[model samples]
Target: MSSPVNIPFLSFISLDREAKTPIYLQLAQQLINAIQRGYLVPGAKMPGSRKLSELLSLHRKTVIAAYEDLHHQGWIAIEPNKGAFVMDNKTKMVERPYDALVSLGNYPTQTGYSFKQSNLLDNPFEESNCTYQWNDGLPDVRLTQFNQLSGLYSASLKRKGTAKKMSNNQASIYFKEQLSNYLNSSRGLHISKDNLLITRSTEMSLYIISQLIISAGDVVIVGELGLFTANMIFQSAKANLQTIPVDGQGIDVDALELKLTSTKIKAVYITPHHHYPTTVTLSAKRRVKLLQLAQEYGFVIIEDDYDYDFQYEKSTIMPLASADLNGMVIYTGTFGKSLAPSFSTGFVVAPKNLISEMQKYLGLLDRHGDVIMQQVLGEMIAEGDIHRHLKKSLKVYMERRDNCCELIAKHLGERVKFNKPSGGLGLWLNWQAPISLLQMAKFCTQKGLFIPKNILYQNRNFTAIRLGFGHLTMEEMEKSLEIMGEYLSSLP
Candidate 1:
């Protein structure tokens, strides 16, 4: 019979009683360190838990837990009747002292590995040191019912079965159905869930649509003065973007028609409902003409109805997609402007086949959206909470818009020319003076007001500003406009 092996307990194997780390983990880690440092040889037998506990003045269970942890981590192994033994070392090689002295700049740049950045990356907006900011347009988040939304989110979280079902695109079904119903009733569009693809934002929807339809060197039409972000997206897609003049009645379809007669246009992007920067709704005659032209030329109409729910003057016009019969119109909209911008929810309404294709691209871009948020928003829509909220917000915003327009007239007067926008959140003001918009923006900044470069629209023939009123309170609007008025008065 073999004699019983005697295992030595090293003096360094002491535990710190005051340390926050538990005894078992400390012991396990220390043993691992010992093996890595070559102090404990491979396949060396360890003291039995009973003997170790006696030697270390610990409970037998504590020592057993330490050994079990080591065994689980593959640092050591235990035999049936025998004690624990150290396994072979798997630690990484130690770094040399000289390696730490090497500078990051010592490595040479790889040859023939150049990065070509896109021109679209030159962002026009600059961060300013101003207290009051004039945005393009955004919703006031203070009006949102956070308590109710939070409750709904919590309730959805508790429903584990429902959440499990939603893991594989099932969660968006109910929300999409509710959204479809709402859009059909409100926007006069006849669409089902199959025609919709919910996205993270309107930007994402635009990106997906651009990817699907606009190929390299394809001729796409946009308003001469249009949404800059959307134009950037089309440009990034390598499309040859042709610009059509925008007048008081939105994009000039006559110019579009002339272009069509000469060129093979693939798509025409427009903001029909309260156009961007200008806020001019395309006239009814122009709408019909544009739709007919789309049929005649076989070009797709991409209509972005960003702030359709905030109309205060006449009844809102139905989207171009509502009147599209030839399947040439693709309508995209967002709830961000209607609700809080942070609660982003945008959707695209198109032919079923196009929607199916958009979903494939959407999957590649984003595998899933916020399921709980969608579920909560769907409930709000079904219960009419969203409609009620919109109604309340419309009343408040109408008052704000009126106040802002009146203030603009009182302060800036005839120096700035503007038409009171009937439906949108901004008033498109054209600078009648020969002052440079870049200089005016700088003057405003000096007076503690920030007007982003992107919001200050300027081309060779036009100079304008889209002063948004939705997000500002009456007091803020008054203060900001007063500063702007002072700057304009001081300008030569």
Candidate 2:
């Protein structure tokens, strides 16, 4: 009824007349982006909706709608007497380790390495053919049997027993048993329902593990060239990451012992089944030593079996979890790579002693994952569709892996060195380098080829890059690698 209010805040919000987004959504996205990017900090009050709308020459309803959406997404909150304010610490880093990597120059140069923080991106896998391919990730479409999934989704939602369970805030009992059985058969893990905590993805499991095991200022150890996401997670937990050098077998256990001589290491995370980027299966000998170290040093071991399902040349290697005499290894495995990414189901087999605390902590963030998807996956496995799908995918990925590796051999195997891993997707190439892997990654991009930067650096040089061929056809793989190898030849 009175004159429209004027807002001094939100001065930077400019309405775009030609954008595909609606007026309110455009305003919401801009505000959320600003807050997320640290342009706006927490405890800063937002402009009144009426005032903002009036200033922008829009109706009050429009601005109110935007504010409502932001509140729902946990980006902003409103108190009874107080106006809305940005949520605290959504983008704020709880813990970060800036000192560890910075002090690399001071680290006794056993692992030839200068840590580059920019190499934090995991495999750049998307559904479309738009993004660059990194050798370490699984395909998007290979996540689940979607048609069967859709049917299960509908049935689960409509089924009488499930509705009753959902009404009472519980999941189907049928699913719990099936999930337990699936793990027991698939991974040789005889875990009870209590020991298995289901997560949307392995990343989710690691994040929960971060809360359980890692704390700010805790020391974390990983292979010299580690999985990008794990490195990021450790950093996010505010743990100092010391990269223990990895040789042909696995991470140097002797060096790890020496590095921990004066330090208090809380956790040592390893991808023993198929070490990312390098594709080195951790030797049985090293695995034994690692387990021994965990017991003697009183540190936890997180074994991430990310890609154990895709063995190209031989029998599947027994996972280190099978040898956990002490409940030290926090073992994790995912159906994301071997099956499909969308179905993103993974489990953490923790020590029976730690399971209760882990569940309480897990419940605080996300309780059990979606019941519908869980039930679907459970049924899929019980029906043998999961194993069937995995074997089919293995066939497809193996051919691609061979084609890519063979091409690399044709072009540069004489100069470069790499072990022919009996199983696993992608080739871990070692170019005993005078040429930097980072430099080659840049040149290869210009030539329409995508490869991973050499994740193996001891102190200062990257002599290798992981070249993935799983997603490409034989011809595309050959063409891309041929161009990539030629460019590497041109270097130095």
Instruction: Write one digit per residue (lDDT tens) for candidate 1, span 258-365.
Output: 988899999999998899979998999999999999999899999999678889866678998999999999999896456666565989999999999999999898
Estimated TM-score for each candidate: 0.79, 0.71
Cα lDDT of candidate 2 equals 0.71
Residue 360 of model 2 has an lDDT of 81
Question: In angstroms, how far off is 17's CA in candidate 2?
Answer: 7.8
Query: What TM-score, to 2 decimals, does candidate 2 have?
Result: 0.71
What candidate 1 gets wrong by more than 4 Å, as runs, is 1-100, 103-113
Clashes of each: 0, 13
lDDT (Cα, tens digit) per residue for candidate 2, span 11-112: 446677787889989888877865654445665667788778877788899999999999999889978777887787644423222222221112244666
